[model samples]
Target: CQELPLIPEQDSRDIEVVCNLYESLLTLQRQGINGIWARIIKNAFAPLFNKEFDYVAGNPPWVNWESLPENYRQDTKPLWQEHGLFPHGGMDTILGKGKKDISMLMTYVAMDKYLKKGGKLGFLITQSVFKTAGAGQGFRRFRLGSGEHIQVQHVDDMVELQPFEGASNRTSVV
Candidate 1:
């Protein structure tokens, strides 16, 4: 058996590489490991907005509002309100649970507040972003330029996973 080098031990400074490492760590943590690096970085940088990222990639956690941790749920309320995704009672309903898709909302927030005009954003998002009434309307109404809006590129179907493998029946890379 051969030993695989740890990600942090690698020398490349590519942001995509860093984000990939973060995603892997996050996946491991969700599986019950003590991986805390990604959460730490996200928390530290959540408040700091960057002009743009050269490369962004990940299968964002699809946790619904009801499943979100208290702190994050509280912190993200304003974003939900600003984006018009907040439900009544400030809580998620069974049908609405996970349906709000904070990942998509966060992506919009990042692009609106951080990405430079004409800058590109590459991320994996649920197909609902393209089909959901609210999200679809929002995307259609989104303005990237004076009279322009965001566009979608190469799309792919869902991959199988546990705990809800096919729950994302319409998953796509957008």
Candidate 2:
């Protein structure tokens, strides 16, 4: 498929559109031997099925904290706090510390839930996540709870390459 329809939550219209697109693609015999082996999960953070893999990779959404829906923010606030991604309080919150991209949380959750020991994960995330002082401090800490830590093996800065069309955000592969 040229593109996978991304509906963060269940929406009948979106699902129908995706199904129709798939059907059209399948009619053209585009699918391989495995056919269309895909699971459109309702939620990535709280997945219904669970499994650990040796490797995981993704380009999580780059929504800022203020852009998130109020309900969603409220619901996931506990998880963010538990993961130490949420800002402490007072000056931290006022200064927008740890309130930048949601991708950081997504990265944390993906590694915490899906990756096995000795596993490696690659994520294409905003470069500001590393350079900003207050924004990604928690993420830079590299702690994954229960005394577990992730060793960042590599980082490839792609800011100068301008790989994406019509996108100005600085990106990096980690």
Candidate 3:
């Protein structure tokens, strides 16, 4: 199971999905939340807790090493280390050096579980993949190493205009 701690960016969506989906928060408002609701809510979002798919999609978290919270950094250090994404977790932010981004990790790691031979994958990702060689090296490496098992189907360059309002960084569909 993916033990995703409620990081800063996902709190709103996580809370909404957890509480609103089953009206558990509504029940809490009238009767006060109880252990049963908590358990039910956790079970209610089982799909979020556990993931395995043939065609994984959607935007994963974009937090890079420098922007990540200290607690999250601590929690994912071992995983990053094992993947060779964040060696020592210190040199990641240096210029021209490969840095760790959650989205980069998800691109391939998801393949290990959700995608396998003959499976396809896609994501709406940041344009950092094109703008910076180092920022997107992990993702590049994943595709490169996948050999003939993975092939580039399409890449929608959304950089002509920003997709997210107020987001300076452009996005892409790949």
Candidate 4:
């Protein structure tokens, strides 16, 4: 969305897409996402938005900014550049290029666009968000309108356990 707003305005199709996906895309057995949304949608969509909702939940794709292709980095720069979460600079180069995951960025986007004020947000993100620095600090840092900030409610530390089979990356619900 080229809309220069804090929250992207959504359309009816977005409602339909999200409703259908969430309603049926997952199973009790937990089938892994194969090839991801890019392969599933064939480039027909973008992130959905609305004025507000009581809550929003997602298990976003877990790919790091450094691992993304150059084109994607270029493509999303307009939206995420201000956060300084993308790969850049000398300090960032040493800190794994200050790599941030796409899901981390989506966390901000989702909270801004869909979540109502004082609403609770929950997502499954990399545990590195609590352990690492640089971009990780950006995730833990919360700022609202007019440079105001929010507070952390709780964090369930799951460092010593593996939540998903064959998934070596440390992750947790936040």
Candidate 5:
């Protein structure tokens, strides 16, 4: 058997499950986290709940801010500011540069709220996040406050491979 990191304080309730409940449960079991129905809420919804993890992984949906539901956009505005995902200048907004993918926020939240110091986060997301000058500018800053920096260790570009069926958007694992 493989040795799993001992999460003494992390229990079944600590595993946040947004979708794919069955799959998440099975993965939790395989990772040595007891699966439970309690605390089955989106991490975005529970901003106060903070539990650190040695590693975090996810494929956050790649929806732009303008495409998100109006209510969701309003509800998460504070969170965006809290994590500094939004730029400070109103010029970015006027130039259409303020638009950002929801996945960027997910990445920031995962690292800021859930990841331990020096922990690793891997996410399958739109490759434009690195190249786009509009919405991705904020993400490229790579700063998490107080001089903390997100050092990207590696990137696997899957754009040419077209791994997703019927989807043409450029993708990458970072």
Candidate 6:
């Protein structure tokens, strides 16, 4: 029952499986048949297995709106409204108003919908999650055994900062 927020990179029209399949085909052509087939199989089966581990972790993407395609912007607009997070020109633009990581929001959504009662979720979020006004407050309220309850254990700064500077900054835990 793990629910994840879908963020469109371009238009909502580009968010379909058809586009993904086409992307896959293009990728496979470039990587050769074997590499492509392996990816296909992996994608097909990866969602069916539940991997058990003590902790769930990862850094989420930090892409803002300007970096996203127009379709994605339109698609996410309602999500921002529904969550009461202001919608701006693009994701990065919204950052100016102090929004938290989409990954942190997604992590909470997953726990609310998927994690069994008493199951724990530990995610690394941006400083914004702890410091922002509206978004952070909303997150805290949700964790305070409020609506659809989830709990927070601990939050720590990344002692090492190098992992945050690469092309995959979004991979940061949030």
Clashes of each: 0, 0, 1, 0, 0, 18
Query: What lDDT tens digits, residue by residue, belong to model 4 across residues 3-43?
Result: 33333356655566665555444532167543254434534
Q: Candidate 5, residues 69-156: lDDT per residue as tens digits? A: 6767887888787667787458768787887899998898788888899999999989988988877877888877444899999989
- Residue-wise lDDT of candidate 3 within 103-150, one digit each (tens)? 766665666556657777788877675557566655554442334344
Q: What are the TM-scores, per candidate, against the unseen true structure? A: 0.54, 0.73, 0.60, 0.65, 0.69, 0.50
- If candidate 4 were superposed on the true structure by all CA atoms, what would the RMSD be? 10.3
lDDT of 6 by residue, 19-65 (tens): 66667777778876532353475566567544544445554445553
Sorted on TM-score, best first, the list reads 2, 5, 4, 3, 1, 6
Model 4 clash count equals 0
Span of ten consecutive residues with least summed lDDT in model 2: 33-42
Error of 4 at 150 (Å): 3.2
Highest lDDT against the true fold, candidate: 5
**lDDT of each structure?**
0.58, 0.76, 0.62, 0.65, 0.77, 0.52
In candidate 5, the residue pairs with backbone N, CA or C atoms under 3 Å apart (3 or more residues apart, or in different chains) clash, namely: none
Residue-level lDDT of model 2, residues 1-174, one tens digit each, is 335555547666666666775676566565452222221233322343378989999999888988876766776677677677764577887866656688988899888988999999999999988898788887888888655888999999999897787999999999
For candidate 5, the per-residue lDDT at 164 reads 93
Clashing pairs in 4: none
Q: What does candidate 1's lDDT look like per residue over 1-174, in tens digits? A: 012344544544444555666677678778875434536667656765445654455566555556666666777677666654543332434344335666666666766666666666766666776676543444435543234566655566544432345463556666
Best by TM-score: 2
Cα deviation of 14 in candidate 2 (Å)? Answer: 16
Predict model 5's lDDT versus the native. Answer: 0.77
Off by over 4 Å in 2: 1-40, 43-49
